[model samples]
Target: MSSSARPARRRLQRAALPISAVMLLSLASAGCGASVGGAPPCLPPEHTVSPSSAKPGDSVTVSAPDAKCDPRYGEDAVISIVFIDAAGVEVLNTTAPMADAGGFNFTAEVPLNSAPGVMAVNAMPHGVDWCDDTGKNNRVSQGELPLERASCVLPTKPLNITK
Candidate 1:
C-alpha cells in the first residue's frame, strides 16, 4: 500500500483499540462490579456498535450484556456474531469473550467486498426451531410458545458501510 493509501487502514486500527478499552472499563466501573457475584442486569439481546458507520475492512465493536443472551444452542451455549448485508444476507463471524465481563462484545470486519449501503448486524440465535440461518443444528426444537416467537431475534443495531 502506498503511504497515502495506508492512512485509512492505520486510522481505523488506532480507533478500534481505545474504543475496546473504554468498553471494558466503562462496564467495570459501573455502579457495582459484575464479576463479584453480582451479575450485570439482564437486558436481553441489547447490543451497541461503535463507529455505527464504517468502510469495508473496518472493524466495529459490538457489545451485548450476557444477561439478555442465554447463549445456549442446545446444550452447548453458543453465541454468534453476524452482519446483515444490504441484500439481507447474514455473514457470520467468530466470537471471543472478554477476559472478565459483565457484558458480551464482539469484533468483526465489514466484508471487504461489501457494496456501499445500509446493513444491519444481528445476533442470530445460532439455530433453533424458529431460526436455522446456518443449517447447523443446535436447538432445532426449542423455545416455548413457538407461535409467539419470531423466527429470529435482534441483539443488534444498524451499521452503515461506506465506499
Candidate 2:
C-alpha cells in the first residue's frame, strides 16, 4: 500500500481500540442488574393474610415484611391488597401507605356480595418510585424488590379467600 494509505489505516486501527473498549464495557455493565430496564434479581416479598379463610364482608389483614421498597417511599409508598373471584373479577381492592418500617399492614373488608369460591388475594407495592426518576432513589429491585421502577408492578402472591 502507499505510505499515505498506510498511515491512514494505522490511525483507523488506533481509534477502533477505544471505541471497542467502551462498547464492551457498556454491555458488561448492562447485565449486572444495576439498571432499571427490566426486573432485577430481587427476592419476592412474602404475603400473609390473616384468617386465610373468611366469609363475605369479613375483615382481613394482609401484611408484608422485609419489603424491598425504596426508602424514599418508606412512608408514602402505596401498598395494596386485591381480591379477585374465581372468575377473575375484582371483589375487593384496598390500599394504604407503607408503615414506618417500610412494610405494609393492609386491613381489607371482603365484599359482602362476593361469590363463594376461592378468591385470589394479592398484596403488592404499587407506584413505588424506584428512585431513578431524577437520581434520588434510582435503584430498582435489588435484594427483595419486585420491579425496577415505579412504572412497573411489584411481585405478589395469591391468598386463598374462602367464602
The TM-score leader among the candidates is: 2
TM-score of each: 0.48, 0.52
Task: Give one digit per residue, the lDDT tens place, for model 2 in 41-127.
Answer: 333245667876788778888777753632334456676667776556777777877654346777867787777665666555556
Estimate the overall C-alpha local distance difference test score of candidate 2.
0.55
Give the range where candidate 2 is weakest over 10 consecutive residues by summed lDDT: 26-35
lDDT accuracy of residue 19 in candidate 1: 27
Over 1-163, each residue of candidate 1 has an lDDT whose tens digit, in order, gives: 5668577765764564332243344333212111222433322345678898999899888876654333233334344566766655555565544312224667777888765666666553333332332334434453321132222334445677898
